[model samples]
Target: MKNKPQYAIESVDHALHLATLLQQEGPLRVSEAADRLGVSRSTAHRLLSMLVYRDFAEQGGDRRYQAGPVLRAAGTSGAPVALLRRVALPHMQQLVARVRETANLMVRVDASVRFVASVESDQVLRVGDRVGRVLPAHLASGGKALLAALPPHELAELYPDPEAAGVNLPKLRRELGLVRKRGFAINDQLTETGLTALGMVIPEPDGRPFAALSIAMPAVRFDRDLLSTWVSALSTAVTATDRDLAAAPVLGQSRGS
Candidate 1:
C-alpha cells in the first residue's frame, strides 16, 4: 500500500471510490469492489448498500452495482438528459469519425424518441445534425432500438389505438421482434424520405436502456454488404458511452437541477 490519506473518513472514501469505479467501468461485483479497496467483502457490500439507499448507485438484474439516478442528478449540469448528452457526445463523435456518417444519441419519450446529441460526419453528403428532432419510436432506428427493449405489455399500452397513432401494431411488433433477435434496429427510409439508420441501445447497469446510439446516412450510401461492419462500429460506440456513464462522479446532491 502506498499511503492512506489523513483525515479522510475511510467508509465514505471507500464508497466514493466504488462510485468512481462504477462510473468508469460500467458495473462491479462485491468481490471486485473489495479487492479494489482492500476491504472485506462484507464491508464492500455495506458500502454499496449505502450507495443504493442514497440513489447514487443501483443494483442491476445481474447483481452488479452501477451509477444511478442520483449520480445523474448530481452531475455538473441540469437534468439527467443533459448529463446524458454530455456523457454520450464523445462516443458519438468517435463513431461519426469512424463510419463517416452522422451519429445520433436518443432516448424514448412515451410514444416518441427525442434526439439529445448528434455528431455530423465530415462527408459532404452526410446526414445533417438531428439534435432536437423527435420522431415516433417505431419509425426511427434509434427510437426503435429503445422501444424494442420495452415489454410487450408496455408496447401495447403505447399503441392501444394504432389507427389514431398512424402505426400498424402488427408490423411494429414484427419489427421489434426482429430487433430483439438481432440485438439492434434498422431504419430504411422510415423516418426521413431518403435516409437510412442503424441503431443499438445503450444499456444501463440494470439491463434497462435509457438511450440509443445510431448512425444516420443517406440511403444511397447505405451498403447492405457492410451492415455487419457498421453494426460493429456502432456497438463499440455505445459500449464506450456505457463505460462513461459508469465512471462519471456524481454524488452528494439534492434534486434541484
Candidate 2:
C-alpha cells in the first residue's frame, strides 16, 4: 500500500476518499460521510457538493450522495444503469408530451428509490428533472408502486424493525394495498407539500416490478377529473416502454437508471 505523502492536500484527499466510498458502498448520507471522513457535517457537505459539481457524485432527494456519471462511466456496474437510462429517455419524453407534466423513472434500492431518469415538462411551474435524487420507497409515488409489487415476505422483511426505522407499517400496508388495487399509486402532496404524482411499475420480463414511471405536477394543477386521463396516458407509456425494455438484448438482466 502507498503511504500518504506529507504534502497531500486534505480537501482533495477527503473528496477522493468520498468518491471511492460512494462507488463501493452505493449511497451515503452526509452524516455517514462526515463520520467516515472524520470531518464536520458541513465539511462533508461541501466536499460532496464539490464532487457533485464535477459529476463524481450526485445528491438524492433525501440529500444523500451516490456515485455520479463520471465515476459510473469508469465502472462495469454502470452498464445496466446507463442502458436503462438511455432506453427509458425516449419513453419518458413521450410521456411528458402526453400529459404536459414532468415524468420520472426510478428504481428501488433497498428501502430507498433513486430517480434514475427524469424529463421536465414545458409548463412554467413544472417539477424539474429528478435524476440522481433518492427518496423513501414508502413516500414517493413511483416508490410506492414498486413496493406494492414486492412479495409479502419481502415487504415484511423490509420493515423488520418498523419503529426503529421510523416507519408506520400499518399505514404503509394500507397505501400499498390501494396501489395494488388501482394498479398505480398516487403521491398526493406526500413527497412534497405542493407536488402531486401518479406512478406505475414497469415490469421485468418475469413480470416482477423492475422500476417505475411517474407523472409529477404542481398540486394546484391537479384535478380529480383528470385522474383517468393521466392514468390512461401513463398506462400507454408504461406498456410501450415495457415492450422496448423486453426487446433490448443489453437489458437481459434486470436494470435500473
Candidate 3:
C-alpha cells in the first residue's frame, strides 16, 4: 500500500474530526470535544461555533451541542439517494445518446431543485451541463415532477401561500395537477427560453418522490411526433435506476461500519 501523506491541515482536520464524533456519538459538549481532540477549550468552542454556523452542529435546549440537520444528513451519507445517483449515471448517458439531448438527475431542496448528475449531448448546439445548478422548482421540469408527487399535506406546507408575493399559486396548482394526470412534467421555455425539457419522477421506497430524471433539448429540434418516444425512453431509464437503487447496498451499511 502507498504511504499516507505526512502533512495535514490542522483546523480542517479538527473540524472533520468533531463532525465524525457528532455522527458517531450524537450530541457533544465543548469540554468533551476539547478533551477528545486534545485542544484547548477556546479552540473547541470556536470549532463548534463554526459547525453551528455551517448547519453541521446545533445548540440544544440545555445549551450543549448536538448534531444539526446537516450533521444528520451526513450520518446517513450512505443514503440510498447516493446510490440512486450512481445507478442513474449510465441511464443518463444512454438517454443522452439515444435522444440526442442533455439528461439530468435532480432532487428538490426546499423551494428549489438541484441537478445532481448530468450527461450532456454530443451535439455542439446542445444544452450545457446542469449538474450543481439550482433553479426554482416551479420553473424546472424535474422540480414540477417531484412537487406533483408530494402528498397534499406536504404540498400545502411547501407552498403555504402560493399567491404570496412573487408567486402565482393558481398556475402552479394547475401545472401540478397536469403533471399528476400526465405522469410526467414538461417545461417549455419556462426555465430557459428556447429550451424544452421533460421529466419523470423517481419514487422512493415510501412511494414519495425525492428525485427526477429529465431531458433537455433545444426547441429548434423539438417535435410533437417524438415526444412519446422521448417520454418512453426517459421513463424506462428512471425505472431501471430506481430498481438498481433498491437492490444496491445502503451507503454506510455496505462499508462494514
Which has the greatest lDDT? Answer: 2
- What candidate 3 gets wrong by more than 4 Å, as runs, is 1-81, 251-257
User: What is the C-alpha lDDT profile of model 3 across 1-257, one tens digit per residue?
Assistant: 01113586889878977876675445778998999789999999999999999998999988789887886763132224445667889888888888889898887877678677778888877887665466888888999999898877787787777766245877778889999998899989987888889999987666677579999988788898998999999988989887776666673244334
Give residue 31's lDDT in candidate 3 (0 to 100). 95
Q: Which ten residues in a row have the lowest lDDT in candidate 3?
A: 74-83
TM-score of 2: 0.70
**Candidate 2, poorest ten consecutive residues by summed lDDT:** 74-83
Error of 2 at 61 (Å): 33
Tens digits of per-residue lDDT, candidate 1, 1-257, equal: 11234577978778876775565345889998899789999999999999999888999999999888866543221226656777888888888888899898887777888676678889877787675566888998988888888888989998889999999999889989999899899999988788999999987665665789999998999999999999999989989888887677661121212
How far does residue 150 in candidate 2 sit from its true spot (Å)?
A: 0.3
Of 2 and 3, which scores higher on TM-score?
Answer: 2
Q: Write the per-residue lDDT of candidate 2 for residues 119-196, one digit (tens) a residue.
A: 889987778767656688898899999999998889989889999877899889998999999999998897788889
Rate residue 239 of model 3 by lDDT: 90
Q: What would the TM-scores of all predictions be?
A: 0.66, 0.70, 0.67
Report the number of the highest-TM-score candidate.
Answer: 2
